[model samples]
Target: MPAQDHRAPPMPVVRLVVSDASHAYLDAVQRQIEQALLK
Candidate 1:
């Protein structure tokens, strides 16, 4: 469970994939992910 929890956030970023995103939401999440990476 700990391992799965740790791996979960990246499943999106690693793929850079959003299953049902509109353009604006995708852009928003991308920026947030980049900020998290920077921190």
Candidate 2:
């Protein structure tokens, strides 16, 4: 019999910077957050 190793997979990290944003920038930021949550 062999012992099994249990370990959790690593999660990804996202970093971003927004300054003086417009509508497009806000939309992009929202999408990024959604994607991260889905993962």
Q: Candidate 2: which stretches are off by over 4 Å?
A: 1-21
What is candidate 2's lDDT per residue for 4-36, written digit by digit as tens?
Answer: 222222222111223334567888999999999
User: Using Cα atoms with residue i matched to residue i, what is each candidate's TM-score against the true structure?
Assistant: 0.46, 0.46
Question: How far off is residue 1 in model 1, in Å?
Answer: 58
Top lDDT hit: 1
**What is the C-alpha lDDT profile of model 1 across 1-39, one tens digit per residue?**
999999898988755555545666888999999999999
